[model samples]
Target chain A: MPHRITSARKLMQGNEACVHGALYAGCRFFGGYPITPSTEIAEGMARLLPKCGGHFIQMEDEIASMASIIGASLTGTKSMTATSGPGFSLMQENIGYAYITEVPVVVVNVQRGGPSTGLPTKIAQADTMQARYGTHGDYQAITVAPASVRECFEQTVKAFNFAERFRTPVTMLTDEVLGHMREMITIPESGELEVVDREKPDVPHEWYHHFEITPTLVSPMASMGDGYRYHVTGLVHDQDGFPTANPNEIKAKMDKLRNKIVRFADEVTQLDVEMVDDAGIVVFAYGTTARAARQAVHMAREKRIRAGLIRPITIWPFPDDQLRELLAHVRRVLVVELNQGQLIHEIERVAPKTCKVAGLTRYDGEVLNPVEIFKRILEVK
Target chain B: MMADPIQSSNVTYDYLRVKKRFPNVWCAGCGIGTVMGSIIRAIDKMGYSKDEVALVSGIGCSSRLPVYCDFNTLHTTHGRAIAFATGVKLAKPSLKVIVVTGDGDGLAIGGNHFIHACRRNIDITTVLINNQIYGMTGGQCSPTTPHDSFAATAPYGNMEKGFDPTTLAKAAGASYVARGTVYHVQQLDKLIYGGLNKKGFAMVEAFSNCHTYYGRLNKEGDAVAMLKLMKEHAMPVKAAKVLPPEKLEGKFLTGVLWDVEMPEYCELYQNLIDSFQEKDKE
Candidate 1:
């Protein structure tokens, strides 16, 4: 039997907390394949979803998992799927389909190692760039990385909200260390956190255009069987959601997709800052590495070395504007991650040239420790 | 027997989204349009409201059926129509979900989803339009391309044997399996109507003609010649049973090949949910 959390406070694994978060955020459908380091989320949903009048289907493969969730979401149900590296790689094609079609779905990638079945049980943040640019086409991604079990619950709810509000897929980037590790987390009761649902079309069925370019650029969506008999295609389509080859309509369609997320970048990016006001050096990190960087910053402050941390909860839309302003005065910015200089290049692109941006990297399927981050901070400073 | 909607003089165009696009992308005299007409007539004969049906298709010439139809339509990725329709059906079992896919889209790249969907016995209706070639991508060889047939990828001749879709679906656990052809319009309508009315996973393989690609490459004249080929070589399942094996050598059998009752995936899942809720009440 699946353990149902009745109390507000409980000690839970990060993956378990994600299931709670999804349920709390009104995710009623889950379609996923069993992948290592992320199977717990699927198992939990399989046990619990049906009792709540939801549906859980174990699809044939990761691609089908992604496709199924998109189909479920189209029927006005909030849906999600979870997978690790190999599964996540298989999902790229359908992920691109979701983006182009503007379907609201949540994908949880519990980070594992490598290019080809690298380290299924170990942790690596190598997929950080893949989360941003894994899909072939040009589109913005709303991705969130959680550092703790508590944040796993919180960030998952946030991921769904972002997905619904933006009408796109949001990637929940968690790694094996946080996915399997246990921590005390206070689960929010009902109505404690804000839950946003997608906007619905209010027009008559005949006037309803599935991809209307509104002032907000986020068109209202209509579910299947709602009498708004609209056509949805993965092809480049006009506002009516039918395939079109006209160059002008095609440009407008692409612009509508791009502008909806880019125009609202501020609302999509979330950061956690610590002691950056009067510090000469700042640590830029995310996911589990940010947890180590947090402890490392405190250790540096105890030694009076003037160190701080900027941990991004929302890792995409790249947090460009915020990082540029934060790194303006700091002389040294150290990018910490479990991969060989993936996110560091992103940091270098935004950080002023005078601000010497460097990377403290590791890629041998091991976690980065606070002491190692601290030593790197000392060397970079 | 359902009243023949095809023979009725006042054929309702209510199920067609005629305003969406004028003159669809299919070639003139393509058998896909005839197959689409049969689907419309079948749904109309069933008296289903346009709002209650969802037409989903993947990328292909035959997959374009949904865009011109006045239903809750979804034209999805290259070969993921069955996977997508599974979600739609599982999430809202009240809505009738139908998937339309071609030979390449349904049997080649989407073969795993196809067989597994049957294995699960989900309540979905799949209309597999088999033209034996990838018509949209310029006559490439497909999984259903007959052995020794010529294609763009098989310039000399195709070396692989074609799949028998009805046999495949029956083996994969579909509760209903049938085969029809565009040449037999009324029979195709009845086959699709029967597949749609079945409760579990149902597959109706409709033989269509891709005169532009498959016909031109093989010197099969035009759409008329290709369809005439189907009329000449196709026999009903009953006729093949009594005929000698040597006598029916090159002939393909049509009509219902398999039909049985099985528990559906969604209803079984709903029962699971009900059991848990009942225990909680206790």
Candidate 2:
């Protein structure tokens, strides 16, 4: 007997792929506002979520959308939201709430030119820094960037898994270029990918604490009405989940929240590397800029110039270890990003002390082509 | 007997969190405690178990009530309690979701969410404490603050007219709308009970006070004097219906102002899902 293979190839846009990926990850609720470039993700969710027995809501604004997803996630439902710059700005406060409460939610920021609604329909990687430090406070953030339509789907599911595993909000950062581009992506069969759910409390109901800090720095989460009647507050609280002004308790809670991401940075960080062996110049890029970097590497190879590309899938954890090892073999490093030297700062900080680091940036709305990166590669020589 | 609140408690204190002190963060003479008492009584009378109830609140003095309650409480960001409750109710329609909010939190910064929640007619109860001023923020003028009233921000006097929450909620399409005060404990309890019984969005605006702030600034004396003033001023909606239009002028009406049955947002969504599944079968 021959096994049948279903046609997995479908022409899909990046934002649309993100919607399907969220569905595959068992997302049951989505609350978000419609913004340029990211609107397709919301529209796709509205059409598919209800059809798939999920709930899709277009909130009045981004703040409510962010709060609503957190609310839904608290009930042990996988939830997400999608938005661009302006809407993402409105969600900052609640994003902080989701962080402090340790709620598992995925927020997709399809990047557009910003600073004050700079360009609604244009692609730019200006929000790389914002994704890390947008909300006011000290906390670790998990942000993944996708460069292709296939990854728009793959990375969105990964974002949900990370959110549930760490019991924190995860961000998927893409740009208008990838969000709008239509390409063929293989849809994996059901059960082909791994799905992670938050750990439920195995303790007795009376002894359950919502913020119980375990040795792993990740605590088990129980939804409302799970026979574990507990309190979830944004205030600094003790292990019992009651607000306290004690400095020792506050430090322990804050330290655990921050260290959870640090201790597991290797587990959370992801990078795609190519042609690094015996390379003279290594290019580090992310999001749409990495697409151009891939092409530039191919062009450099044809000209007999040794060029390598290291694309970061997980941007928040910075992929410092991977770059430190790659920088050792290279004479110089060229950091390419859509913004003006944002991730370059991280590269320069951790790059081998013997190697010089330079940045090739494009803050304007136009997407960087392969020629721009190729030109930078030649200049670095 | 009154001095020993724990001994003389009429309702079950099982739902109340034991960790928080008996004396909450409310001001010395604030009326929020009375309102909170009324809400607890209503929940007690409704016969809801502690496990089946979920209380959510936004930032403000009134939002602090959730911390003192043990029923799956979620103290959220400022002005987002109702929105959060909407998500909870939608996710678990079996849970009785309630929001405790203040005038400044619910009507000012959170006005958009408040109106949308009412418009959607989601099955959740919101007890809005209209204190006429932002007591938590030390007396800024709020949406429900009376015109020409003195607040810390409105030193010269407020220039805007206050809103009647019952009318605002009704216009926003709440299935049940009511207005009561801390002065009318029995009536407020009954109104909240009516809201809980409804299957759609229900709002009970309990006109509360900032005796430490509003009373000091307006010369309304203490908490007792403020309650007395509200008692004398508040007219029941049923009573106002009988009086002539001119005679009812300058009177604030209380009691349940509106009640109607409508398809709830979550239930409608569930039915919609069923309908979609039904189509797939055909």
Candidate 3:
């Protein structure tokens, strides 16, 4: 039997795909404030979520909207919130709370050009580092970047799964380009999709500790009102979720929280390798800019240059080790992003010291073109 | 041979979750304890199972109400209790969701969420403990802090106007809105019960006192004396009709001000699912 192949299916915009992805992921609660670029997500959720037995709430502001979704998720509902730069900034404190408290939440940050409302409608990936370290603490965050409408749909679902499985906040790090762009997507029928639920504690309510780590380093969650009397706090705490001033307890809890994600880096991180098996030059890219890099890689190959593209789907817990291996053979690495050299720094740190590393940076609110990336690749070479 | 008028059940207050420890965190004669007591009594009267309720709160003195309750409780970040409570309610609509937050937590830093939650009309009861100052943060100005009130932040006076939580909720499309003060104990209980029973967003703004913070700074007298002052200044909604505006001015109105039903956000979503299922069947 031959596998059925489909061609360029009519696609939805990245933001629209996120809405569909959330629906498919069993997200029944959406609390968000309407902001540009991100508003489509909220609008789609409001219009479609209700039809699927999911609630859509337009909160007073980004702060409450972010908090409400976290609240909704505690009741064992799949929940999410969408925001742009300013809203994302307001949500950082609670985002940190979500991190420390180990609340599973999907936060969609549709990136806009910013440093304080730089351009609400324009596109930029300046938030790459922000997504990894925006919240004010040392806790880890899982961030996924989608380059196209289809990836948006696919990755948003993945984001929810990661958040639930890890019992931590997962950021769908999208920008205005992918969020607002419309494209055709062939969504899989129900039951064909894989959904992951958070691991509930096997221990009875009386013995259950809310923050106790299992062998897998992931804590078993017990919803409130189940007779579990454990405390959850933003302070560094022991396994019981109670505040502990003990340095050892703090170190143990913090290490487990951070290392769980890092140790399972293989399970969490993902990237696309194209023409990389015998390439001398590698272009590392993510999100919308990755689209252009793909084209640039092909163009570079057409010119008889051995060029390849490494497109990261999971931006955080970055594929540093993988990049190190790829850089072993590749003579030069060109990192292209719609930001002022954010991920380039990560690449610089990961690349072999001998490998020539450079960045193709942009923050002009326009998507980087393949021509620009090609020019930058030539300049670095 | 005198008969005891108060039975053990009446004297015991079975709904009180932490009764063995009678004296709570509230100061003597503080209205917060009274408000908490009324909430417990109302929950008891409503016959809600302790196991089926989740009390969530933010960082504030009044937000500590959830800590005293033995139900599934969460003392979360400042001004974000409504958000956390929203999560709990959405996750378990079968459970009654109650948010206990002070005026500062709910109306100032959290004002955006407060109004939006009402607009969405998720089925949750919010008990806004309006003590007129950020008591937990030591007498700072709050969104509900009255105009010309003095606090640590507002040394001379708070020239800014205050928020009327009930009015804000009503304007924001809350399905149920009510105002009660600690002085109106029975009436407060009734309002709380009504709000709890309402199908959509239910907000009960309880005029609590912050004698330790807002009181001393504003010369509102001691805790006991401030509570007495609250009692003196409270006027029932029905009685306010005959009283002159000047006499009734600044008096706390105590009663169920609004009660109406609209489709709750969750139920509406459920209907959408039903409709989608129908389409699939077709």
Q: Candidate 1 on A73-139: residue-level lDDT in tens?
A: 9999999999999999999999999999999999999999897999999999999999999998897
TM-score of candidate 3 versus the correct structure, residues matched by position: 0.89
Fnat per candidate, as a fraction, reads 0.93, 0.73, 0.63
Quality class of the docking in candidate 3, CAPRI style: acceptable
Ranking by lDDT: 1, 2, 3
Task: Point out where model 2 deviates above 4 Å.
Answer: A1-7, B1-8, B19-21
Docking class of 2: medium
Note the Cα lDDT for every prediction shown: 0.92, 0.88, 0.83
DockQ for every model, please: 0.86, 0.79, 0.48
Best-matching candidate per lDDT: 1
DockQ-best of 1 and 3:
1
Which lDDT value does model 2 have at B229?
Answer: 86
Give the lowest summed-lDDT range of ten residues in model 3 chain A: A1-10
TM-score of chain B of each: 0.95, 0.94, 0.91
What would the TM-scores of all predictions be? 0.98, 0.97, 0.89
Superposition error at A260 for model 2 (Å): 0.8
Candidate 1 vs candidate 2: the lDDT winner is: 1
| Candidate closest to the true structure, highest DockQ | 1
Query: Model 1: which residue pairs collide?
Result: none
